[model samples]
Target: MSKFKYLIDGIVKNNPTFVLVLGMCPTLATTTSAVNGMGMGLATMAVLLCSNMVISLLAPVIPNKVRIPCYIVVIAAFVTVVQLVMQAYTPGLYETLGIFIPLIVVNCIVLGRAEAFANKHSVLESALDGLGIGIGFTLALTCIGLVREVLGNLSAFENKFSSSDGMLVFVLAPGAFLVLGYLMVLFNKLKDRKKKA
Candidate 1:
């Protein structure tokens, strides 16, 4: 009910990544670097916010059966905007991010929020949801990215293609899966303890 509660709810209790478990594609891909993770997160946030606002506007008119397709159209439009802008300005990120950029359209987190929270809520509240979930996704990816970069490349978020430093053999795709699995287990245990306390 408080203003800060909205903010906290978005980032913590209702985190899209750790809590809702959406958007696993970019979560697994561009998260190799803090920068990459941040970029993807922000891009997705922009699209989410835009789509949420539009969906909220059209919620009354959109047929329930066709709502899914409508959401995709809105999301795809925003994602195309991101792809073009990124390709034009941040070509390096464009290259590094690769197919994942386009994949944001299908990201469960984006579409899920659009269908669930955004359509039902006010535009402002939906924006808050997007902001909260987007930031949470960024933070989780950045944490994993930091860990992978440090242990695997002797740096935080070094180029995935270039291993200029010592290779710890635990930062690749398989290692990321291992780390994500362990992190999920650790988070689950923490959640259990929190409930107990």
Candidate 2:
């Protein structure tokens, strides 16, 4: 019941991307393609899950004055591990993501969860929170990336959709903002309708 609320909150009511609007850096920078978006999402999710668990375990031991710094150290350690693994196994995606991978160390979603949720909750709850938020973030990015890829590159899931004809702009930085803005508007409208119903 209440234990599961944290998970649902992250995915629906308090989504890191759509609702909370946290972690915009990677959301905007690494989502140039569907694959890139999924890659970035999973990488961030891994760090989020691990860090949240570890932070929860250490919360009682950490001093209040130095908690933030301690959280950063824990988060950075996980990010480093993820980075090395990505570089070793997924070299292409690793290269595509570039600095954004390491940038996850400072992602607001990670820090926010660490400080706001994990520090106050049990290990299982914190892990679930991280997983839910990570999934939400991943889904949002994947949707945006899928749309951009289809419109910008005329491709989806490695398959070409209309003979390589595309808007080109949809693949750029401005396009990310444009798509995200429209999606946000649409999402809000849907939520309003749901509430009314």
Candidate 3:
């Protein structure tokens, strides 16, 4: 049904990272390691879910002229909550993500979902959309992080791949782009094959 479609769309068909290509800033910047990627993804997911639900609930009451600002305010509030909680509990990740944590306020995925999907959808639907997109984003980042980690640092999920040195470039900014680009190509090829069949 329509509800299921939203989930599928966000995860596979219109994934914010690979398919729609939104929020590339955090996608590229925070995915230096699997832990960092998952942390950033979860942080963004929390904000995305909260903002989507709140925005959907308030859409009717919010004035059209000021909706964007209102959405940003709501998102910023949630981002602050996530930031504080992470800082208090996960200081290492907090320090690793640093300014990017606060920068979630402007992530296009959150704002775009608020405007494009959440505002127009029911509360439940908005939440599901956020969840699906958030998961997809998380998975994408984790995969990229895993690849970079294994190849660049010879580790994954805290497991050592080898004592030998990995390709250092895979851990750098350029490595992020290289991995992401190739992943996009692979995803597109699979999608094309699916369509043809």
Clashes of each: 0, 0, 0
Top TM-score: which candidate number? Answer: 2
* lDDT string, candidate 3, 1-197, tens digits: 87888887888887999889999999999888898999999999899999999999999999899999999999999999999999999999999999999999989999999999999999999999999999999999999888889889999987886999889999998999999999899999998999999
**After superposition, candidate 3 runs with Cα above 4 Å error:** none
Which residue pairs collide, candidate 3? Answer: none
**What lDDT tens digits, residue by residue, belong to model 1 across residues 1-197?**
66456557878898877778778778877767667777888888878878888888888899989999988998999999999999999999899889999999899988898877888888777777777777787788888777767667766555555556645655578767777778888889999999999
Q: What TM-score number comes out for model 2?
A: 0.98
Q: Which 10 residues in a row give candidate 3 its minimum summed lDDT?
A: 1-10
lDDT of model 2, residue 60: 98
Give stretches of model 2 more than 4 Å off: none
Task: Give a tens-digit lDDT track for model 2, residues 142-167.
Answer: 98888888889999966886885799
Q: List the candidate numbers ranked by lDDT, top first.
A: 3, 2, 1
Cα-based lDDT for every prediction: 0.80, 0.92, 0.93
lDDT of 2 at 78: 99
